[model samples]
Target: MANIEQRGENSYRFTVYLPKDAKGRYPKERMTYTVEGKYTPKQLQEHLDHEYLKFKAEVLSGNYVRPEAMTFSTFIKEWDKKYASKLAKTTHGNHVRKLDLHILPEIGHMEMSQINEFILMKLLDGLQRKDGQDGELSFHSKRDVYRTLKSIFKYAVKWKVLSQNPMDGVEKPKAKDTEEEYQDLQVYDEDEIAQLMEIIQNELPHWRAMFTLALAAGMRRGELLGLQWNDIDFDNNQITIHTTIVLTKGGPHIKRTKTRSSKRTVTLPLSMMEELRTYQKHHKNTREDSGERWIETEYDWVFCQFNGEHMYPSSPSNRWAKMLQKHNFRYIRLHDLRHTSASLLIAQGIHAKIISERLGHSDISVTMNTYGHAFKSADRAAAEKMESIFLKK
Candidate 1:
């Protein structure tokens, strides 16, 4: 069924009929291969016939890797559209960024068969910094890159595009202790929180309400910003966290909470509730002063600009920095407020499960792992209490 056409001197093209289809057609999956060598027409045809027979055998066995199969670039494009489209936007964005910045630049042109553990290790080595070598990517970033690569390969294997994944036993790059330690210290002490609260109360009562809610409810900045008046239950002394204001590339977007657990209701302190009521009244007055200039979004956000437009996602963080500098207080990221709330609750002997619920963590283990150091002191206190009780007995 295959035809070998001689084009010029020492050049010929071979066309072949593939294996049987569901309709029993041999040419259903046709293939064309070029055979150019220093052989005569008869010799070239014989060689092409042998190659065609081998190709047919492999195709029948589902082991055929066509010469015109996907390149890394084409495969990745398909991956993004078909598979990665289901991922969260932020996660998908990170994957695309890593592929563009790290992975694709090196092995993008290679065929699927060309990819192996050795080639992947070489790619990892290219990302790593060694003696007399300067690489901008960190070990943690390289680990992320490796994981992304593994995910891509895993998808390829699932679709039978690749025979096997090369990242099965690949070693991950390790991050330095300094980076880990820095992550551990990303929280503020109770005294620092108290100091910040005192300063904000005296100078900016409106902001005081915001900070108090953040500390008392253990809500993330985005969750706080996304809050609407109706989401708060002053009667029940609770606030429902159903959504968050995520900072997207386009602008601030109101999206569902990161997880199902993040949609739970958290109780607020009576004092914090009073502060919110007062702030609401003041905000209403301010809006009245703005009059026609006040813009209304369908969300009816609790926290917004004077014109009632939704506040930018970064506004809280920006205000946090300036407020700390203005009050001459020690600096902490705005996110540390939530950590501070968890730490204070731990110090007060609150159960880990309770704190985890307040913080809307998907699992109690997540709360324990993140604030494990806070629990160490609580553990010591528990031991001392047990000892005292036994002595009294």
Candidate 2:
């Protein structure tokens, strides 16, 4: 049994005791946890109960590490073994890679308790992008490190491994070039979109259907690559996005979506659905003609090689580049097709929330951040509409 005490309005302390050995060789005190937060009385009680059970279990299970002796590296190993499995496979790999490349090298040796906001801030101050020669990191790299560290120390504190989370004291890095990135964004305007549509029509059935879906649904490239046949709803004319393809040195592998929100059902145009049916018929003929050469899997990949194995995740981008060059069309990243879809929707005065959902963004703010210019263009049109109502002309 552990003793629980209320130290303040919402602060609680839990003290755990270890049983004494017959030879009086074992220490009696195992650990003490103290945390302060805003919680209702009922919530506070639940928090205290959870803290006690977790603390008692750790001591009894011999899993408790004395706060004084615990290193960031040690905690990371424990965390990775226990909690990293919950993350998507690619995300887990990326987190581990970043920790090894940047974070672990700086603070892995230090005691978790000894690291402060200053140490963490200094560590962040030294981060740099892989391609850059500058001393400071880009907002992208900074955000990755910031989120990684914040998640790590938050878990440490939650599990009672540390008394406080120093990350709480650190300011999150902000992207300074939000407007610049928006200005520099690539999107096919209405005319270019029409031109693209016309050009892709002459392509092979599979390539035509794949790129058409990209422009129609705003799916990420990985989402398109990982899409399986069964994910499509023929009756509703929709496709469910739940998995993504990740490429590694070994080969391409399938992984679950990055966030819960990334798994969504997007309704697509009826005409495009007919295009898919045509492609499906084409695929059926290919599978029969290929005979033993066709490698069939349970996945039934919508887009694949002639042998039926899924193409390399980058294959679409590579082939898309060639197709554009062959057609003498101005080139944009295949991913910009997603932006093109959003830009076209905004041009039609589609609501931001609808665009966010269509893009499978976790929040509308993400849509706003990426497509601020599109919204500004729409807002200008809205102002002109008001002028038509109020002015004589």
Candidate 3:
């Protein structure tokens, strides 16, 4: 038997009766569910009715189990080994970390079948509240946690553990203003770049060539570190980027570029190429002096330690930060150099398509979306120039 009772605004209780006991006498206790949301009265009744029908069908089919029968904590641990194992190492690590740190502490004890849309909404809203370990998380972080839960529920559906995914009704959070603020703070200007370059030339002679290549080609930090002497074409003045250095928990690992577009051939400026050649000569002399002490890999990396070992992926960023600090320059992360390259190109009337290719973005839309503000500024400047040329007295 199913009966729906209103329990204030946007809330209702669904009372479901169980089968008779051994002596054909009904049990005193029944299941009552309190559902809450933004639903109107009619919508709330409709939802309760639907859930009642589904529960009756499951019971009639001999498949109904009480909500308290299965816990989420038990299922998620099993899900990790079987499903999470199929994911990439880094991705799998992220999933486990989130599950352990943020998710499990909140909902792990609840049964999967008992978790409804209302519960999911409350959990997400709680995450947005400024009461967690690091205060209120960003929309993106909350969204990621939501996504992980969604994926877990999807798995539950696939395994026939639940008939519906509660997250299907939840709205994913939108981009907040902090994203724009962070992106704008992640780049440098022409004057700052010139000053940094001069300091790099004077003080950090060994890393000067790599830093120059970073600003000039917009190559990623990993790509720059993975470069080998053979990847460079001195005659053609182009460098092929097919590999990258990735740092994981274990150690530094050599892997392919982030995406297909990331594995590109970028033409080097003549002066930059000459500087690289000069650096190559100096590196060769140093290697010869080191003799048997040089630990050479198969590729003979262009950038490495004094003993010719692979450089850690984080070293470049750390070194760049230290150099700026020592010279009393404005602090910008090493990756900001890539943004600087894009900003400089956008300011010089270069087409977005060409800049996208130079930056090795998988899609031009990514490049456009990232640099839209810069493009807007450039567009305004272009319009002013046209007015000066044709409308001036």
Candidate of highest TM-score: 3
lDDT (Cα, 0-100) at 284 in candidate 2: 91
Error of 2 at 8 (Å): 14
Candidate 1 lDDT score at position 358: 93
Question: For model 1, what is the C-alpha lDDT against the true structure?
Answer: 0.78
Write down the TM-score for model 1. Answer: 0.72
- C-alpha lDDT values of all predictions: 0.78, 0.84, 0.79
TM-score quality measure for candidate 2: 0.72
Off by over 4 Å in 1: 1-73, 100-147, 171-185, 202-206, 384-393
| Location of the lowest summed lDDT over 10 successive residues in candidate 2 | 26-35
Rank candidates, lDDT, best first. 2, 3, 1
Please give the lDDT score for candidate 2: 0.84
Question: How big is the positional error of residue 41 in model 3, measured in Å on the Cα after superposition?
Answer: 51
Error of 2 at 218 (Å): 0.7
> Regarding lDDT, does 1 or 3 come out ahead?
3
* lDDT of prediction 3: 0.79
lDDT of 2 by residue, 137-177 (tens): 66667778888999899989876777799999999876666
lDDT of 3 at 379: 100
